[model samples]
Target: MAFLGVALLGLLAGAAVMYVLYRPRFEELRRQAEAEAQRLRESAQAQSRELLVQAQAEALRVRNEAEADIKQARQALLKQEERIQQLEERLARSQEKVDRKLDDLERRERGISQRERQIERLHREAEELKHSQQAELERIAGLTTDEAREIVLKRVEATARDDAARLMRQIEQEAKDEAEKRAKKIISIAIQRLASEYVAELTVTTVPLPSEELKGRIIGREGRNIRAFEQITGVDIIVDDTPEAVTLSCHDPVRREVARLALTKLLKDGRIHPARIEEVVEKTRQEIETIMREEGERVVYEAGVQGLHPDLIRILGRLKYRTSYGQNVLQHSLECALLAGAMASELGANVQVAKTAALLHDIGKAVDHEVQGPHALIGADIARRLGRSPAIVHAIAAHHFEEEPQTVEAFIVAAADAMSGGRPGARRETLDLYIKRLEALETVATSFPGVQRAFAIQAGREVRVMVQPDAVDDLGSITLARNISRKIEESLQYPGQIRVTVIRETRAVDYAR
Candidate 1:
């Protein structure tokens, strides 16, 4: 600190001395500063000149390298251009060759088409030549060509007929040889499955009384009730000396049902007058109609038939109350259907067709009184009207053979109808009368040329004839039966139907004792 103080003192003293001595030294210091700035500028200029020289050399080297790469790239591009030019020339030549080939192919296609037409013409001419030759051959055969053709056809037909006859003969012989055993078995099968109780003429129907006095009431005031009842029911109300009961009667079922029900109500109300009787009958009529509709539908359903007319259905219902001979018609129809099915099964026929035909065979009986014609024919007409098939109509008409048996099914139906009515208990006859009848049948049958022993069965519905093996040939039975039948028809008056059976036996045996 003292040294700084002494220096400051000396500087003050020296400044006083310099201010007096070196006032002229300021110009010399300015000249020295100018000289140092000039030297720095000269050095900086020399460094810039060296940098410029190096940059120019580097730029020249880079330009030479770029020129060399450009020259190499130019050479490669020229080579690629030359190769593309060669490919273009080849493509032009190939296109020219393809155009020439296409022209040649078109010319060949035209020539081939012309040849195909020529071949077709040749084929047509060949076919015509062949046909002409055939015509010439046919003309040379005989008479005219048409006549020769007829002769050839006739020969073919004759040969066919002869072959068919031989076949039929063989079949007939074989069938006859097996007929007896097969017949027995088939008959047994038919009988075994048929279950029907015996039936008799049912002339009496019982109507229970409301009370003991109801019987008197049915007699009515002045017997008007009885008269009205009989007239309406078409039946004889036999109010006899019996107690609490009356016999209802009518041949027609609808009439009988009407009478029975009417009497029942009348007896219950204890009102015995014509007015009351009429009113009750009208009510009974409605009830019966309902029952009739239901019954008719049931019959059609069970018969497995459809599309029956309503009117026909009503008629069918009446059969429910109707009886033929003694068997109920409805029940008889079902029995017939069953028998027809069995027979059809045995015969290899349409069982449903047989059954339906048989069931409908007697449908006409329901309205026979109001219609005209044989029952079978009438039934056939009705069935046809109801849109049944022609086959069905034919079957129904021919069931009784009233019409010719056009089909095996028709004969089956007839057989079924007979089976239903003629079985024992299915119809009524006294034992003595039945026996006498059978005896007469046998007598008449035995009177035929090929004399035979006869036995009546099924209460004379059927007759069995065992002929002498020598007297009757295979066909003689049919002829003899026809003869017997003609005689029976003339000599005997029978009901329903009768079946004729001819039996022939041949046996080879040795007796041993």
Candidate 2:
């Protein structure tokens, strides 16, 4: 028991010594822990304070932004309210103006009603007065009402008839003027399509021989070759002393051309027998017929004419070698066809009929030597025989006034013929004759009453007369123009119809100083 007590006491002493040694170290650790906790708390408090300050600043900024937005919204609302008030004021003003207009309209309506009532009263009074005046006139004239009415009716009828005649004359003059304008426009357009320099007459064809010795060979033995050539080709072969040339003359240009060509070939072949000459002449005649046929077709195509009989076409081809007054008949015919077509189109006439008639108008001249009548009449007969329309036949016949123009196309064909034949350089004429014609036209125009001056223009196609305005009124000018035109038709022998115009002009002049 004593030993146990001694051990216990040693244990207690050791514990007490251990506590004394570790208590200081434990207290030092507790102090360090407390210091770290305090340091942590201070840092946390500072961080929280800084966060609070930042939150306060953010709240201030938010509040300021919200207040500014509210201010802007209030300003916008105020502007809207001001605009609405302005609109209301404008609407009120408009309403006032509408009310005023309505009142003015009512006043005007009342005034109009008063004026209508006054007019009705005045009309009734005027009717009564007119009746009374008519009765008084009947009583004073010692006539019954019926007789007075009949006389008045006759006077009114006469006056109306006079007025109607005047109006008819005015309308006719206007129509004629319009027709003349349209005709001139169409003629001008047609003339622009062709610009022929001059017509060349073909009477004789001269064949050039290569050598002077060839002429003798052409004459052949004892003039036998020349005689055979003349008999076969129907042309006179003139073996002149001229160097290296021979002339072939014939009234028939086609025969003359064939003779010339045959003679040329004979000389080239160096064969001067009657058999060779016959063969060459026959071949050349065939070639010429072929050429004429081709020329006819070409002319027909150019003129836009169709549906002609073959015989008519052949006859038409012969016009290529025919000429009148130094003008090629074929070219003149073509020009006439074109002019007629253009004028017919303008006048609303039959264009085909016009063109066909104009083209075939001179076809008779091709065989005029064989026919016994005028070329126009012969051409008309030929056209009639060739299944042409009566209108075409008439136009062809009337182109030279052999027959009176009975249709619009006939008149157009005549006018086209005149235009083609009357153009400058189309036919051979001396300058003196042209000047005399112009002077005659002027003289005819000046012979009219009230004409102060006269001028012949458009190559004697038109005569313009200047009349004294004081002497000739509008109606008098028309009468004067008719008189002048009639006088010209009676006195002048012009190729084409001359247009007589009377011009009455009034002028007012003022000077500024």
* Number of the predicted model whose lDDT against the real structure is largest: 2
Candidate 2 minimal-lDDT segment of 10 residues: 195-204
Per-residue C-alpha lDDT of model 2 across residues 62-105, encoded as one tens digit per residue: 99999999999999999999999999999999999999999999
Query: What residue pairs clash in candidate 1, if any at all?
Result: 198-425, 199-425
Q: Tell me the tens digit of each residue's lDDT in model 1 across 1-513.
A: 999999999999998998878767977888888998899899999999999999999999999999999999999999999999999999999999999999999999999999999999999999999889878887786466678788999999978766766676578669867986886676568767775454544533788775677777777778887888777667898878877788886656677778887877776677678777778888998998889788878867876666667877886777777777677887787677777777788989987788778778888988787788898999999989987778889999988667889898898887778767766567666678777888899898888866658888876778888999898866666666767778898788575567788888988999899
Instruction: Give one clash count per candidate, in the order shown.
Output: 2, 0
What lDDT score goes with residue 213 in model 1? 77
Q: Which residue pairs clash in candidate 2?
A: none
Off-target runs (Cα >4 Å) in candidate 1 are: 1-177, 180-215, 231-234, 239-249, 345-348, 430-436, 439-443, 446-458, 461-513
TM-score, per-candidate, Cα-based: 0.53, 0.54
